[model samples]
Target: MTVETIDLDAAGVRALNRRLQGRDGPVAGGHFIVTNAKGRHALAVGLTEAMDVRIRGHVGYYCAGMNREADVTVEGNAGTGVAENLMSGTVRVTGDTSQSAGASGRGGLLVIEGSASARCGITMKGIDIVVGGSIGHMSAFMAQAGRLVVCGDAGAYLGDSIYEAEIFVRGRVESLGADCVEKDMGERAADGLQTLLERAGVAADAREFRRYGSARQLYNFRVDNAAAY
Candidate 1:
């Protein structure tokens, strides 16, 4: 298949997004390459097609927010909220990302090859996130569902106020947040993690990681736990 190239400096983001979303006309599933993406915000937000898009440079906030069915890849670093609210498909970042990466994502796979800053995967509601490097403080705060796999160390307050979601960390965790506790990584869990790591193209042994999940302490509104509320 021929790869279509879109230059951000020449066409701009709005036009590029419109074409990718099929706003101009009927669009087919194909490969697209975006060049000269110099930290631009909202570069490819709200795309609903099943196209493969590769962004070649650093991008600003919300790089692929609300994406569905499209496979978006950022070859360089990403700013805050990368892949936020993604409903399906894959979003991969080859370099590091800033705060709130994959925040509120409902479904899909987010693969970050490098580290992520604070609040990565905050409020995630069923998306699978695999981070190859470390994550900063407050990662996965208020996560409702899905899985977060960190191949490297995690900073303070990991999985604070989590619910139902599972966190797998291969390296050290600085602290566990409210209602989050260490869970046993049984054989079944390890098997599942192995599949996820393969899907994310991460090379790591599932047995080397630890699992964490909600303690179910704050689920009921008991007056005794009012301080946590």
Candidate 2:
């Protein structure tokens, strides 16, 4: 396949995308290798089908937003919500990512080679996120189901108001959320983190990490905790 390189400022990029929609090329399943992208927002929005997109530089916001069955990889840092609402396939970031990476995603895997900011993987469902470095406060807040593996420390209020999701942190956690407690690191969790590390190409033992998740106490609203409500 002949890969096309589109060098554009933010406005030029949008114009090029609009022109692409008019062409007969397969917007859904076609492969797009984007380079020289200097933190442009909404890089690839609402793309469907089985596609492969490799971004060569940093992206500003909402890169690969609402992707479906598209394998997108960024070679640099991502601003925020790198893979929000991703349905399937994978989104891998080779460097650090900002806050809310992979927020409210349903399926697929998001791998960050470096650290992640606050609220990473918030309200996720069935998505697996693996971070090679530390995660900030409120990581995995209100997470429904899925797996989050952090190879480093997690900040305060980790897994606040979570439900059914599993979080593994290799370092210290400042505090656990309401009703959330530490559980014994079993074989299943270990194996899961190991598999994630292997998939993300991270070289670390899963046993080195500690696990945190929801207590299901805040799954529903209560009058006593009205401040949270």
Candidate 3:
């Protein structure tokens, strides 16, 4: 496969997208290395094709946003909204990420090798997220579908107002959110968790994790359920 390198100082983020969008350069279906990323915002947004991308340094807000069919690896920390609204493929962060990472994503997998800040996976439609370290407060709020596997601890109000998303955490949870409660981890569920862990390359055993999901009591919002809100 072809390998191309882009220095953010030499070519701006927009210009780099232009070249990749052309699909006539090495970025079409090859590998890309972004050097001197220097927390550049929106480095690889709106990519519709498949490719292998490695960002050497930290990235600013919304890096790899709206991605489709691309495997992106961030070697450093990712700022807010990393992989937000991703449609397909995989996005991996070797370091921490800021708030709202993977928010509203519809498909694909998002793997965070380090901790994630607050409001991660908010309103997520159908994206799978695996975190290697702790996650901040109010994670998976209003999530509709997909699975989120946290190999570390989770902050308060995790999965608040969650719909159908399933969460598995290996560490202690500070608290649960509205209509979200712990579920019994059966053999089948453990199997699913194991599969997700393997895909994310996390070595932890699935049996160590606990599952959480919607209590189904807040769906109709009855008068008694008002307190749950």
Candidate 4:
């Protein structure tokens, strides 16, 4: 398939995105190739269509924030807030990502081929984050929904104040935040774990991962649960 190439600087990329969203959005719904990224910020923000976008190099903050239906693949590393507040679509980073990757995302899948920095998937709601490597401190803090799958070690204070979001870590956890406890991975969960691994294109034994979620003791504001606060 032939893809139209957008060889633009940071400002030009933003302008194209702006022009595309002028009326409902630009119908540039075919395949697109974005070259010369140069670690610029916000290269493809607020895209609301079913287009396949491939970025050739590193990108700065918010590379694919608030995306929908589009499949964005970055060939290099990404700065902070990659796919932040994403509603739908898939963003794959071939290299590592900075802090707050997929923060507050509602729906969609964010796949990090390498490690993610601090606060990865913080406050995630209904989105799925699959990290091929380790993640920094305070991941999934206050997560309300969705899933966070880590293939390597996790830093301190994971899932702090976590609410219902599932955590699957294949490596050792330095520490667990408040109200987070290890749970048994049943047959159904094992199947789902494999599915997520397949979706993210990472190879790992599902049995290697352990499940974690809310203890439900802090689900309500009870005096006894005050210690978790």
Question: TM-score for every candidate vs. truth?
Answer: 0.95, 0.87, 0.93, 0.92
Best by TM-score: 1
Query: Stretches of candidate 1 above 4 Å error?
Result: 219-229
Model 2 CA deviation exceeding 4 Å by range: 15-24, 27-29, 219-229
Q: 114-202, model 4: which lDDT tens digit per residue?
A: 99999999999999999999999999999999999999989899999998899999999999999988999998998998999999999
C-alpha positional error of residue 10 in candidate 1 after TM-score superposition, expressed in Å: 0.6
Please give the clash total of every predicted structure, in order: 0, 0, 0, 1
Point out the worst 10-residue segment of candidate 1 by lDDT. 219-228
Cα-based lDDT for every prediction: 0.95, 0.82, 0.90, 0.90
Candidate 1, clashing residue pairs?
Answer: none
RMSD in order of candidates: 2.5, 3.6, 3.1, 3.0
Ranking by lDDT: 1, 3, 4, 2
lDDT per residue (tens digit) for residues 1-229 in model 1: 8898999999999999998898987656879999999999998889998989999999999999999999999999999999999899999999999999999999999999999999999999999999999999999999999999999999999999998899999999999999999999999999999999999999999999999999888855356766775
For model 1, state the Cα shift of residue 60 in Å.
0.4
Task: Decide which is better by lDDT, 3 or 4.
Answer: 3
Rank by TM-score, highest first: 1, 3, 4, 2
Worst 10 residues of 3 by lDDT: 19-28
Off by over 4 Å in 3: 23-26, 219-229
Give a tens-digit lDDT track for model 3, residues 1-229. Answer: 5688988899988887776555545455778898998998998888888888899999999998999998899999999999999999899999999999999999999999999999989888899999999999999999899888898899999999988899999999999999999999999999988998898898999999999999877756457766876
